[model samples]
Target: MSDDVVAPVATAAPATHEPPARDITDGGPDMVQFLDADGQPVALNEVNSPYAEYVDAIDDEQLRSLYRDLVLVRRVDAEGHALQRQGELGLWPSLLGQEAAQVGAGRAMRPQDYAFPGYREHGVAWCKGVDPINLLGMFRGVNHGGWDSNENNFHLYTIVIGNQMLHASGYAMGVQKDGMVGTGDPERDTAVMAFTGDGGTAQGDYNESLVFASVAHSPVVFFVQNNHWAISEPNDRQFTIPPYQRARGFGIPGVRVDGNDVLASLAVTQGALDRARSGGGPTLIEAFTYRMGAHTTSDDPTKYRIAAEVDIWKKKDPIDRLRKHLESKGLADQEWLEALDAEADELALRIRTACQQMPNPPHSEMFEKVYAEPHPLVEREREEFLAYQASFEEED
Candidate 1:
């Protein structure tokens, strides 16, 4: 009777959707590194690194600012990792090895510029004045989003891969309509930057964004942080060509940066942002960097990525190179370094407290921001939730 009543056995599990093919030359091999593994700036044009005439506009003060930002941002990232390990948070995406890439791109942004970030862009969030606790809650399982997208001129952390690129494009379209481009007045000029990864480049959202940005001449920058691996998938799995070449196909200029070299990243980002602000069309900046840690605290890279790959990236550690640059300039005295360490410790403690204090959202909270106006469906669901919660037996 059971055999007769049973549903037919499935022949195969649903076929898995394969990821997009990898590009062997989408972005140039290795990366466009300016400062070598040692952190000293290399001779321009000697390596594959290209120069923007605009780079000449930068000064030492700006370079130091980039350094400070990278240091603090990395500290914030590490603090987040520690919080995850301590069980104060559920998960944390490490910016462990991409500080220079974030700081350089962030510092290049004007106050009027807007940024769209993926979930992993905490370093960029820090650059936009977001409190690190905001990032903590998402991983802590305490809340969906910690900040308002409009709050810091930064959009909410988009969890869907490459989705923000489209949002950023839409925002850039709005900017174009508002006449933000070619305003000439620095105070009135505006540009948009969207951050994603190598894996995201395969998403149609990324390609679609390029199309919109190019056709609209939208003042936007597609910042691709090619951290070498998209969770379990290696860079090779994402593209057959390097990602930067995709930008050229979109009819926009593209640049590659030694994401580990703060100076170079700074130089390139500044140039790109400036170009966009001044009515130059969109550019895609492939920050050639590495993800030194797991994709998230929940990931285990050793399963798909080899130890040698990570070791190779270790030589290009962004923070180390920046520290070297700072030391060369006599800026990293023991006192200064100690003070930074102490500050990081204090910041870590604060993050721990905040994470621990993050309370569980109320049952009604789920219905809070789904719509601009009251929604009958949400109201019904919230009522049902409340009634369901009340059904629980008395607590001890």
Candidate 2:
């Protein structure tokens, strides 16, 4: 509700007079990594980055939790995939290797935090208490959205490329107008995590969202899950440099992390959330992960991407890497991990059952929730549709 438009800032970090630089360092798709691909403890004693503190705080239980997160997140993802394959849904977007990125960031948010997620952010929706069955409803072509966003503090699944960015900025600005930012109360302070993919970075909305957030110093985090491939178009096609560096041009603090690494993802997101809550303004986090599966059930990766890349990414699978890391720390027991696997299987079955039970909605779906107030045309259409339904046989 605050209709304030802001001009762009050209600073890298928040400052008293002005920020120092407009360009931050680029690590050639390898910067901000706190964990290794081999699931080994490689990063230590780093002064160049402020995120070193959180990276050092990772414990065994937390590591196990991260492992469990991937297990469940992957299950939800696979369930969505099966729904599409079984013809229960129209199209399904896969977050195969980006589990850690989504779960970590989603977990980083406090209950008071609001999220504006892209279409494929079902992982985040799960974290926000959105039912898995509801997630399928959208792709099932049975509903526009699964649940009321206000109920869980999450916005609708935005399909238009980067449109959610503006919606998020607008929401964040409202939080500012309501005196929610810098309130000193953690619960009172509202931060937004706007999810987008690497491909959406080319969108003007994404760029403008950053501009508005930076100038207004809104409590927002632009979470870019850079899964490398934007459908068929690769990351290189979008920009010459990495997407994390794109944040600097908008005068904001930017960090890139090993997206598939749960610990790294959690650490970076937690830090960014903390910063935003403390009135440090918006930070852009580019989770450098891979989209191991096809963009969606509709497209085949075999057509455009090479198998060799898939094979390489498989070796760096998010679930496998986290499990290995947890095992190395003596946190993962065979019984526990096995039980977790069983739970995943049970969940898959439960969702499969739900898919079968999906009800066929009446043609009213064409305009049911399109408006809060009744329009004359919509009212007439809805009445006609109801009459048509009555023409069919019914129990009543």
Candidate 3:
């Protein structure tokens, strides 16, 4: 298989180039929000208000689907955590509370669009129809990544933090050079979605990607899910301003949306994608959310942050917000919610079973997939490994 790559309101219907109303000068977190902590709707400002229509476009059925997606995504994450704890996996990077930011952006993309994700983008992988079982192989030590990225246009997760940014930018450049950008035909044209964490913003690769993308006017959307903490180091240590604002310095339009607000995330991402497909160049979207769990199975948040902080973010849970909105809007009832819970339970079971059933790769496989063309050195290594295995059999 081949390897491949991959918002906001304002008043008076502002032009696409206009920036959202946000002040990062005071080091305070100011983001474009369409929903509050209570799951109550909030009025959008002039810059962000434009996205209200996109949010409005989601029907009742789609809303319920989004909620279901959120629940299942969380279940997958929780199950992964449990598996890691039980020694079924070497490690797992839990997506935890960033469901809306992922689901919202994921659902907004067309099938033709590509996604380049960081290790924690399980929700995005789910949205792209990547089997959850496929993701387990990596942490289970079976393979680097289980799925064929070419099949779904979702690249294998980049565990190197900011490394995916360069790959994504290069892919976008290829898309432009191949005459794939600015095509009026919606189905034919494509855009790239590059994901990274707040910590990744500090990496040179990330900044370099922005520089290349900006100069090339690549058709890509840089999505940074700023989950507050970069493995215990707070956002303050990373930058003076928010991650999105950094796009402005590179001459790329940027906006920060409430990552917990599913609707806002979907709409804002959709707008950015639309612009990219229409040759508007790259846009950076900062999803301001929090990481409810440790960075990975190896981390412990208690040593650095307090439980009270986690509790505060819980009140702004993405799944709960959408579920509340659905209930209040009469789009879902207690019975439907319960069914969804049962479905999530089934999914969790499936994930656990599949993860356990994953097979370890053959020792010789190490040298087999190393290159498309065979080399004497790799062949020699493979023969040596096979001979080594034969020696063990002979002893038995």
Candidate 4:
């Protein structure tokens, strides 16, 4: 990644009377982290020991692939943000510093498992085989969702905050009833994963979904990418305690992982998904990461946050950490890394061209999907709309 694309850590602003927000840079002792900010491996301790086996089992090829994923996903975010700025897209929610949190959890899922994502899970969508162009259509105002949800076992991006949790819980209950859990068959057993943000934890739907999943013993994983700020609100405004620590109240096992550490994120999420698939019920995974960009293209972080905080997280960039690990371990060479960079350039161009070429949906399309069967009211509205459009054409 270029230095220009990465936001620089600025000097801290003059202190104010308001109390300073909690320093969440270090995810506390309980946070599972395999790779430190400098890309050095940390000594395995009781907190992270259980998840270490999963990371240890990863082959060299898999490690290189993880690096590739982190790079490509970041490129995707960069391109999307650029497109929004260039007016090709109406808006974009950047995954920025949260690449490892999304990709690690995303790669852990099997083909049969389903995912319910919030609007910003572009990294997860990429891992689930959705074309980057498909993701742009919604932002471009061309379609409600550009891909089939069932085709990839990835649901459409839910714009409503925390709503997918309820959807995922209900689907998990159905999967349980269908006898798809604990079948002793790897291919048949299925798990559901719901993605949300730190702010989502405050929503009533999020709590309700936990209740439903707990009572039903549903095979689901609630993956919360706690990126510190909930839009303009800091973590202090959202909760009294970290999300992972609060999961116990719901009778679900919760684990906090260093969201910037791809290996740790993958290992912890894999463990949780494995447990759920085996009918162990639901688990909550709090990926302790940071959002390096604005909440969306429409948001301006400078108005609400300090550049110092962004700089702290920037040192812990997921892509940089993985790249360092690959270099130090001899998993990827300079030539291969350069080629991957070239590949990212190609990907960016492809998506940019695709976005520019996307045709706007017909004006009449708004009325097309209102009902499965044609309704008299809808037909009348369509006729009126067409007449209105025709009147404009006559004047032109």
Candidate 5:
């Protein structure tokens, strides 16, 4: 291991009923953190020096922009949660606390880069130029997915756990075959990013994708947002070793970053992506963060986790940290902050209005996209379904 990378220390597992008490604030010595929990800058150190140049390249305007992204993304999450509560959506997965992780990684990609995201990557979608309303349409049950994946190079949200990793691996291999990797031409070189949560690491698909990506030398990065829970299950239930450490077994370089620190997230991800574009194969980035909300509208996080744990993580809120940094650095003032908050409110109103105005597609519309060309079997089923509906209408 390089001096920058620290090896994992194994600890005895606690009893089944009583899980080990984790210090939520600490991301361990190996985790790269450019900003401390209080939003103060951490001076360049061994673990973070490799990625400092990336952060240094960001200008004052860009720093403020990142802070804006963080604020708006959190607002988006609040709206999504509210919409679900009002029965506007069938189901909604809240990205309440993972905004920095998603936004940082999203902004690191070039125009040609592709992203395969798990369902809750709203922040990534936003950074990739995907409209917030488009995301809401899916949960509202009005459309399969609201946007064309090809339009923005952001794939439709994948609902199945870890499935998108395989898709991303295959896509990366395809990009390699197309001579997109290691091309000195910046416009031609491409890298793929696959996003998943902590629970996804336990899936066979995730492991298999890594194997293919390693042997094929595919240009891809696996970003695991270790939000500390896979639904109700904690990290202890997922793996004995952290995801980044396990990347070594697959012959890939692994790094852990403080997910709440946007600068660290952006810098580290940019480095990994640069490595991938230059034909360095894949890297696994485990972003140490927390899910401050329920797993979904259907979940009750309070049932499984204690309020104290949530309170501890709240002190490290990603948005609050970035705002503090901006204020301390004189990059923003009260008036500027208020204006951004107003913009967020406007965005929330727009999202709410767009969602309520979405037209529900006719049930028969499902059959339209089942095949590119007309098929007798589908036609038969469509007719049968319509006839069944007609019989109910007649009775009424």
Candidate 6:
């Protein structure tokens, strides 16, 4: 081939190089940590540590309640997964881990504050005082959502990734317009929280929400539960910069916390939400955590990741860590722990029974809410559906 004929330019096959190694120290500068993997208490720095005061505020009773919440939430999640496997639920998104992240954030919010959750926020729901059976109803196909969002100030679970950020931001703006921010009255002042996974940060809505919140100084906290995987894709594919750092680009302050450490999660979330309620503007919190189970009941983690990695994270089990800490401090004993286990078993039984007893909605129920006023097409369809059902009945 002549030089003028330049052989068809060979393009190197897309680089199959593995992701770059992440630097620990610099990669996570804002990581607010209160406990180590071994459940040992770590000293707090008043100047640099964002969560020191929050962690210091916890008493023995609250510690025990946190443990109980963790246990019960785990049990609820486990039962939901089992019910799905047994064909009782259409699907289940197990919060097998990350209990600490959800519970801590959930517990920190004031009753007046509002929460917008991703689908896998069972622990948060538990903290909001939603009945466990109500959660199972949605999975069982009996209701669109189990609880009333207004009643609990907890919005329905949002399956669409990152959409809740927009909703929460809008709600926060509404709260501001209504003069609910910086009232110095905890009972009247309100802030909004939006929950999302690490992958959610990649969505346009997330950025748009941040822009609006930052510009308006809306009373909202954007909480990203960085479970390391957005479904099968790892965090590296979504973005190289740490999620918390990304907030700086949007002009919102951010902090990263050891999500597995419940106390840290609680403290960080509380701090962010408090800032929002105080008219300080939106804040972003990246709770660095892991997903121990499949993304959902339909997923198989073994296919994409190795067992050794899971084993490593297992050692950092949130529940186990907290339990050890409590035991070591003489805050709880074997007897109390065993009693909690018995309560968990009873809760599991109740969940199983309630899930099985849920009534399936009638076929016509779908048409009932299609329109505020009766539409000709919907009426015709409803009639046709009922006729079809009648055809299945025996002739008398």
Instruction: Name the candidate that leads on lDDT.
Output: 5
Q: Write the per-residue lDDT of candidate 6 for residues 286-375, one digit (tens) a residue.
A: 887888999999999877766665666788899999999998899889899999999999999998998898888887888876778989
Which segments of candidate 4 are over 4 A away from where they belong? Answer: 1-23
**TM-score for predicted model 5 compared with the true structure:** 0.95
Q: In model 1, how large is the Cα lDDT of residue 292?
A: 88
Return the top candidate by TM-score: 5
What TM-score, computed on C-alpha atoms, does each candidate reach?
Answer: 0.88, 0.89, 0.92, 0.94, 0.95, 0.92
Worst 10 residues of 3 by lDDT: 1-10
- Model 2 scores a TM of 0.89
As a TM-score, model 3 comes out at 0.92
Tens-digit lDDT track for model 5 on 241-293? Answer: 88888888899998999999999999999999999999989999999888999
Q: CA RMSD for every model?
A: 10.2, 8.1, 7.6, 6.0, 2.2, 7.7
Per-residue C-alpha lDDT of model 1 across residues 1-396, encoded as one tens digit per residue: 011222211111112213223321222333455667777866656434444443555566665666667777887888888878987787788988888888878877888899999988887888888888888887776676777778789888888999999999999989988988898899999999999988899999989999999999989999999887788776556776566655667888776677787767777887788889888989999887888899999999777755655666687788788778778878777897788778777887888788888889876788887999999999999999887877784441
Which of candidates 3 and 5 reaches a greater lDDT? Answer: 5
Q: Spell out the clash pairs found in candidate 6.
A: none
By TM-score, highest first, what's the ranking? 5, 4, 3, 6, 2, 1
Candidate 5 stretches with Cα past 4 Å from truth are: 1-22, 391-396
Clash count, predicted structure 3 = 10
lDDT of each: 0.77, 0.79, 0.84, 0.89, 0.90, 0.84
Misplaced by over 4 Å in model 3 are 1-30
Clashing pairs in 3: 8-47, 8-48, 9-46, 9-47, 9-48, 9-49, 10-46, 10-47, 10-48, 11-46
Candidate 4, residue 330: lDDT: 86
